[model samples]
Target chain A: MIELYLFLFIMLIAAVIATEIKDLLAAVISLGAVGFSVAIMFILVQAPDLAIVQIVVEILTIVIFVAVVFRTTHIDETIGKRFASTHILSMVLFSLFAFLFLAAVVQSLRELPRFGYATMRVASEYIRLGLSECGGANIVADVILDFRALDTLGEATVLFTSVIGVLALMRKIGRKR
Target chain B: MRGMSLVVKVVTNIVVGFIFIYGVYIILHGHLTPGGGFAGGVIIAGALVLRILAFGVEPVSEKRAEERASAFESLGALLFIGIAFAGLIIGGAFFLNFLPQGTPLRLLSGGIIPLCNIAIGIKVGAGLFTIFLALAAIKYVMED
Candidate 1:
């Protein structure tokens, strides 16, 4: 639909602007806009759960971005670079890559199974046996916490390790004399 | 870093409690609702970050808060692992449904899922707040 395409177009523009902007805060804001459009696209495609996750994650990302931007005055020195032959070449290459990426994404979207089409073999089983077998009314919760719990465990470990890394890095290196 | 405007601080004071409750609600109802642990954790972290933003780094007592966050985050991760290992002990498999599953749609119906959600909520919330504190304009934060 036109609305879907419109959202995609906005996302594309936001991506471009996010990179092109000189101010770090402006760039972060534009990237947040990109996240917003993607969340809307998720909603339009009948994935409300994904949409909720996307928006919440996006908000947190923006918060982090703002924190970094405000804490660090100068993010980079690349804004000084002006129009040049390399810049022109990079722009052309980026455009070609973006075109190819969009083409592949569109093709994959078209190939995806239709809504309510029951594509996966285990999909029906989950719908039928999830409540009885897993004893959870929400099939999604059952799938995550029961069926794919090991994966969740690994994810938790990863988060824990990353937090540890952050804590370690935040501590001052070397002892005071 | 200094705190924001008085209005922002006042609004944050009122809204933060509501945000914390909402985040807990999301985690508790995750088994029945669309959201789950990670999403709820992020919401909880958002609430804490809001307070940090309004009050700034000084009143937050950066070092102590960071330590608490790290501790809570590890506790959550350990709790999740303990649940899985407990399942292995009783059910002879990792992450088995060890608890007595009650009727569907009830709070106690999800066996170990609710506990897992709560653990994830704690881990994620604490972890994210730690990250925010690290990047925040604290004493260690590089000032221009």
Candidate 2:
């Protein structure tokens, strides 16, 4: 429990500093720190599976960000262009929005079905009959590939499209080809 | 990303094979474990990325890798759609579980589940590698 709070506090600090930091590299690394903390939070919530996926995906995302940052010419020009006077106003606006979003999220979390409880009928049904009907020991595998297959197919299609897009963009004919 | 030190290259070479095998294990055992195609595929891509990081793009042939990854990505997507269409042909519903569902706890028992995992694994692995490779290649070229 204490560890969970520690992770949350680290994430909060990372978020604020990552945004406030002027250095792009530092900001990117701080954002990754937040991702790591969130992964830890997932583990604390008894979602090891999610934690695995989150950590791997987060690592890849950070790699992509680092690659982009290094590849680009104007590393600091992005945030440097913003007026100094507007920074104060934007910070105040950001704080207000962040607080509102946090309140809304907390309210939604309160409305969620209790964790470890079997109140969700469809989910309970999946757990109870998944092995018998789906003929698989892993209920998650059964649900994604058997019960919710169309969604997976859509996801695959999107991945395929993105790959194609990247290849096209990287064509040797032109830089943005 | 200009090919890390010699020690890093040696370590990456030694470890990447194990990571690739582990990813395959996770993908194949999706029916009996927590990890499935996406997690396993990402892990596999991570292994390749590790190699790229240690070896750099010039030696790795970013162009060649992108072409192969693109081909495999297309193949994986086609294979996935082909399987789904096969199900529709056999079972009269798209994405239907057409194969016989065998006993539980076995690798080959999940009908189309394992097959889907394999397809997803290939699609995701190749796709992610391609994306990273493309970005790295562009960055490398622009810098040069």
Candidate 3:
């Protein structure tokens, strides 16, 4: 649609402007704006979860940059050298890679089975019988907490490991001081 | 540093308060809403950054705040693990929702999920706050 094209055009312009901006702080703000725009696009594409994650990550990244900039006032010196030739080359390569990957994903999307069919045949039957077997009220909850409990356990373990890692790092820093 | 006009100080205070309140709202409504622990926590951290920038770290008592944040981080992690272990002790699998599911689509309905969100919010907020403080401390030490 015309609106989508307009949005894409604006995003492209914003991306170029962000990259071209001489001031590091301005560039960072512009990049954040572009990220927000992309997040909106993700929402429009029916990926609300991904959109939220993207926006959150973008905000964190922007805050980190702002903190760094405040501590170090000389932004011009921090802006690394910009080479036109390498930029173009890399851009082309990146575009090609993205195009190929997107093509594969689109192919997969077409080939994938519809969730409704599987749900009706496999999941629904299991759910109908699950109350008698699992003693859970909700079928979906039963599937997630009971049938796939191992996966949930693994995820919890991963969170535990990361928290431990963070603690260890903090302690190590404390000892160094 | 103390020579700043009253207008600037008032404006900065209002802005900082707004950011902090917004962050808390996001964290509290995370389970039923779009915003979650990480987003809300980062927003809170941003408010701290703004406060530090407007009123320098010295005025804010950054070191003491850093210590408090570290304690909060530890408590958050502990609370998260404790919730998980509670399920195991209740004869259910790990991380199981032991409490009654009051009603779906309600804020208080998702028993463990809301608790998990709170724990995550605390962990993220404190973790980020600590990192910022540590980084600032490094700069402070180097300058001194």
Report chain B TM per candidate. 0.93, 0.94, 0.87
| Candidate 1 colliding pairs | none
Estimate TM-scores for all models: 0.89, 0.88, 0.68
Candidate 3 residues lying further than 4 Å off, grouped into runs, are: A1-9, A45-57, A70-177, B1-8, B105-107
Poorest 10 consecutive residues of model 3 chain B by lDDT? B1-10
Model 2: residue A165 alpha-carbon error in angstroms: 2.3
Candidate 1 docks at the CAPRI level of: medium
For model 1, residues B11-45, the per-residue Cα lDDT tens digits are: 99999999899889888988887788888899999
lDDT of 1 by residue, A1-177 (tens): 689999999988999888877788889999999999999998898766678779989998987788678867645568767679998899899999999999999999999898678688887887787888777777878988998899989888898888888767666555242
DockQ of each: 0.72, 0.75, 0.20
Q: How displaced is residue A158 in candidate 1, in Å?
A: 2.2
Best by DockQ: 2
